[model samples]
Target: MNQYIDIVLRSVTIYFFILIALRIFGKKELSQLNTADVILILLISNSVQNAMVGANTSLISGIIAAFALFCINYIFKKVMLKSSFIKKLVQDKPEILIHNGITYYKTLARLGITSDELEEAIREHGLEHYNEVKLAMFEIDGNISIISGNEYLKQTHFKKKIIHKNLAGKK
Candidate 1:
């Protein structure tokens, strides 16, 4: 019974410690999950699990893992700030899946994104044809960025026109 109580208290305490550690990790830590962040999270969770379970995992191990994670993040951020090459290596370059209505098959294959997936992505943006798309960028985070070729040519909305007219009148 006492052992069960100890386990419960330990779990609760570790849970709060994780929350605090995550907060210290920084805003970008959760909002903008990069490759390194994802890897760290995977490792941290595994380490914490071991910490939660006794025998193989110890309380000290959990605290050490948390501390190590925090240190690594701090060091990496410092390195990234000073080095552009390190930044590029850790933060992957965006891929160009489609350019000027023509699809980059090799790029898509390399990204493992199928034609159907590409079509679905573009279609979700309310785009009907590839010709309407001027530049379709594949972000490092696996997000599709679609820009219409006619964006500049497209007529301004009435709301924008009215605002412009009102500003002109004031001027």
Candidate 2:
């Protein structure tokens, strides 16, 4: 096989391997990257680079590997759009966490969500308790979306905020 073809084949193989690994691990890993998550991502990229290009570390080999990855990704997305089973395999279905103030404890446990995490998501949406929630869903993107029953409170999308407190007292 040509060296360029070899590079392309290796890159595509690694791409599918990572995709399958992500599917088995769950979609929650896709959201909310912490310091550790960032580190893991950097390490994963570095680890896979050699595997994709093998001993050929030339510029052309690198470009070929990248092109192969992008083409495979585009093809995968198109196939998923036309095939429900492929789409379901790659993405998790949204789950209902709460409805009419009734919390789904079983669903929470199955999704590995703790009570504290649920309460934090509720409080982030300005709700005092689970009883105030009309509906709460564990979205496919790994976010807990809350809909409150209060008429006065305007409906709004919840976005997670990361606060970096300044150590210096000076404002």
Best by TM-score: 2
Say what the RMSD of model 2 is: 3.3
What is the C-alpha local distance difference test score of candidate 2? 0.90
* Segments in model 1 whose C-alpha atoms lie over 4 Å from true places: 1-56, 152-171
lDDT of 2 by residue, 1-171 (tens): 999999999999999999998888776777756798789889998999999999999999999999999999999999999999999878999999999999999999998888998998898888989999999999998888898999888746556775556745545
For model 2, give the 10-residue run with minimal summed lDDT. 162-171
In candidate 2, stretches whose alpha carbon ends up further than 4 angstroms from where it belongs are 155-171
Measured by TM-score, how close is model 2 to the native structure?
0.87
lDDT of each: 0.66, 0.90
lDDT of 1: 0.66
Cα deviation at 162, candidate 1, in Å, is 34
